[model samples]
Target: MRPVLIAGGGLAGHACALRLIEAGFEVELFELRPFFGGRACSYRLPGYGGSEIDNGQHVLLACCTALLDFYRRLGVEHWIRFHDSYYFLEPGGRLSELRPRKWAGPAALMAGFLALPIFDFRDKWAIVRGLAAVRRQAGDHRLDALSMEQWLERHAQPPRAVERFWRLILLSAANEELDRLSAYHGVRLIWLAFYGAPGAYRLGIPQVPLGSFFAEALWNRYGRLRRHVGQPVDKVLINGGRFHGFEVDRRVVEGSAGVLAVPYHRLAGLVPQLEADFSEWSCSPITNVHLWFDRPVTELPFAALLGRTIQWFFAERGGSYLKVVISASRQWRTWNREQIIQHTLEELKEYLPAVGSTTVAQAHVVKELCATFSPMPNLEARRPGPVTAIPGLFLGGDWTATGWVATMEGAVRSGYQAAEAVIRWLRADRGG
Candidate 1:
């Protein structure tokens, strides 16, 4: 049997390799970078006291089934801790918690909705009506052209409440604000989060560095697969309208099946035929400011900040690590490191008063200019499926048509789907 070549060694590639290997197929993974994990990768901070920091802060919701399953399969489920509820820290240092009550059916949803402190009484009722509207909408076309902001406004949603409560929730889930996000994506995200599990609002964070977690867990499971790093695929050579193979510098590797799991922007150049539609697919930026404090500022696992420079902060076990994630941060990317750090730290002090006098041991800012594909209106039309027009060639990135924004779960799901498609094709070929 010909070996299946998986390109771009990010989450999707890694996942594809794992699944294909399990299906008794020879797998060769090609990664352009010296390291793995792609956007989710981590490295030691240069001047920030040598602490390991991720490219950006990533949080998993309880509704992330695929991500949780991936962790369990990789045998690193213990490395992550889940918070039962969400805590929002206002700029004025006020704290608000959203916890779900243990009631059955619609009662639980109602209880959870009522428990949220951010929204007013009218806003709470509006949420119920909005969800009903989402449930009533049957076809995808109805949601395609509309933005979440427009949908809420049409439904008479309070702007202040939407900004403070609804927008925060949407920002973290969709990676874009309601005004720019698709109504379908926003509604789907909220529905999944609220209606999925009993503790659906739970948040999970990594206990160790992301690299170590992946290395010890995922790499260990697929120990036999020959992994090559620092070998970025420069070009994919297609012949007879089929996937012939790829070229990495002077070396050439051939495979019957391949999965392209790199970022969307990188895809067009890798395969020029994709250039036309690729440019139409825009991306959103995510910025994280990692600050090391002398002591713990807050006992909470993670806190959402409103009406401040900081959006969210998380306290890691290593230290009081404050992470400020600015989603749709296109403009923030232009700011210098010092300016970004100073602004984030000042906001941190406003929320956690203890950080006012305490000296910051270290500070670092990390940015992912193209952190995620923009989930704006009409994004559904732009997103492509795993299977392309080329035979034995598949695409598996968060940017693919996963109905999920650029997320770990989405990446893993795409990988799994691509691998399954490859497996079926290979099996049919052999049988023939």
Candidate 2:
């Protein structure tokens, strides 16, 4: 049989290719860039003297089963380092750590949350109640119409509690402000990350560059997959509402099946028949300010900063290099490189005292304008499924209806779902 064509070399495309090959189908994956991993990729800066850095820091929780399974398939599971504790730093360098107690079972997280000094008695009470409400009312369809902020207010969540606890976590998770995020996603995130399993909330950071996870040699293990990097699909060719093949470099590349695994913004151009309204679909930005100091700054591996523009920072190279992350960073959209760096340093000095005396040897700022699609209220209903109107053609992307926000896990789930749809379609066509 001709190979199944997969467009986009992101997690979704990679996942689809692997699954199709496992199901006894030849797969051909095309990527526009010379490298793979899509947004979750790494590249060396032109004048950085061969120092490789990710486009953005991509972290996963233990609840990301699909993404982990994908890593296991590539034999790179060991490349990720899981952290048990989450450090939170206040403006004056006050430290608060949240880590589950050994053998405490499901109550471990709750116990840890209660022990945090960041939340006062009233704040803790409000958060505990809010979590209980999330457990009871997570999947209710009515929650989709209301914003997470409104839901929090209706539940009598204190302003301090909302700002210090809920907003910090959900904004980074959903990549949007509470007022713009849907309560359905917010509540679901709480359950998935906190209640899915005992170790569900443990953070996993990649020990190696993100691009290394999808190296060509690793993918070559699957003989059925034919990877075509730096090759962009020009168009999706369909005949009488049936998938034909993809047009690349002004030539038709025929395939048994095709999966449009690109971003939502690029979907209409590929398959115009879908006629989906993308006008309402919007994206959120994330900013990463890389600061390399002359000496080690913070001893901690990673920490979440409170009451500041910088949300989180991950220390690398023995704390000499810090990757400061600003999720939902629409505020910095207008700031220049110098402005971002100066402001990040000012904030870092307050949290990490060592930054006040250290000199920044180098600094680089990366602003991902379209880091993720905003999970706004009522937007979930518009997300498409794997099956499309055209036969032998499927859609695979994190923006699709994967029951999760635009995370690595959602991307892999979409790919697996699309591959499953193709398996059923081709099997029925052959009467197998």
Instruction: Indicate which candidate wins on lDDT.
Output: 2
Write model 1 residue lDDT over 255-373, tens digit each, in one string: 87878888887877778865537655677888888877888878887888888646787777544766777877777878999999888877788888888887888887888788888
Q: Assess candidate 2 and give its TM-score to the true structure.
A: 0.98
lDDT of 2 by residue, 134-211 (tens): 889988878999999999999999988898888988988888999999999999998876678879989999999988
* RMSD (CA, Å), each prediction: 2.0, 1.0
> Cα deviation in Å at residue 178, candidate 1?
1.7
Alpha-carbon shift of residue 263 in model 1 (angstroms): 1.0
TM-score of each: 0.94, 0.98
Q: In candidate 1, residue 406 scores what lDDT?
A: 82
Question: In lDDT terms, how accurate is model 1?
Answer: 0.79
